[model samples]
Target: MEVVFERVEGRRYRVGVRRSGRHDTGPDVPPRVGVGAPVGDVPHDLVHLAIEEALGLRLGIFGQVAAGGDLGGFFTPPPADRSPLRDKRRSQRLARAGRSDTGLSESLAACVGHDGRLRGADELLTPAELGRVQRRLTALVDAWRATPPGGELVVTWPEHLTVRRGVLPSD
Candidate 1:
């Protein structure tokens, strides 16, 4: 798996991921997946694809940011250069309420449904979703603690992207 990061603005990073493919390529062309979201734009499709590929199943999971902070600050190549005449109020709402945290998990749950099952568009997160992300992070830390480090996993925190990673110093 290959992870690509493009600087957006502030602490935000636009992440592009390409991983091992199971599909076969034509004799003349290589099979490639183009997953992109316009800078500063929410790449929901790309995110869904990442989760599906990572977890081996599609999900109704959604990523949200708080309505109080700069949304572009979460990804790389942010779209701050756009017109400011847009709806500042609604934008603020999304910024403040849409941030990643339990809020993200909540939104994922909402997308799938309030029930914690992974049904059609109503399935947001399974206990497995939480476990998958946690395990992935732990493995990264463990690998770093080991020798001959190889894989790269970027964990971004523009203004602290929190989602329960074991216990903090105080806990």
Candidate 2:
């Protein structure tokens, strides 16, 4: 899946995701998933991506999406057919939310969501991991900054980190 962040205006951005093959949708989820909102220092989801990817939190928000699971309402699903069975299947797939890293990524992203850098998150990440996430965020934010209005920064969800049944975090 490719995550595209488009700059709509100063401090405003929209995120559109395109997954290979048919998009996963259900009774409550749309065929397409995306969001548009005001941005602070950097895009909120971008922070989630940076922290989760750097820390290998595969069952976090992006991982859920990559595996075609609706992440509650954090990401907006635009259009699609609704099926009760599909929704139930999606729920089963997302059951991995019980993993600590899932919530850990959400909490960690909040720490740097708007500020675009890590702050006081040492407990969640070791010193080495924190440094890595910070560095990765800096690079991602830079790319987003350099993108002109109407332009987009597209990133691929790492294939190895994508959530899969029978494969999950040790925790």
Q: Give the top-scoring candidate (lDDT).
A: 2
State residue 91's C-alpha deviation in candidate 1, in Å: 3.7
Per candidate, the number of residue pairs that clash is: 27, 1
Q: Write model 1 residue lDDT over 1-171, tens digit each, in one string.
A: 233334343323344333222321011111122233321222232333234333432111212221112233332222455434332443344444434443343344334222222234324456776566444434433433232222233322222222121222221
**The candidate that achieves the highest TM-score relative to the unseen native structure:** 2
TM-score, prediction 1: 0.26
Q: What is the TM-score of each candidate against the true structure?
A: 0.26, 0.76
Please state every model's RMSD to the true fold in angstroms: 16.7, 4.7
Candidate 2 segments whose C-alpha is farther than 4 A from its true place: 21-39, 72-84, 95-99, 113-115, 165-171
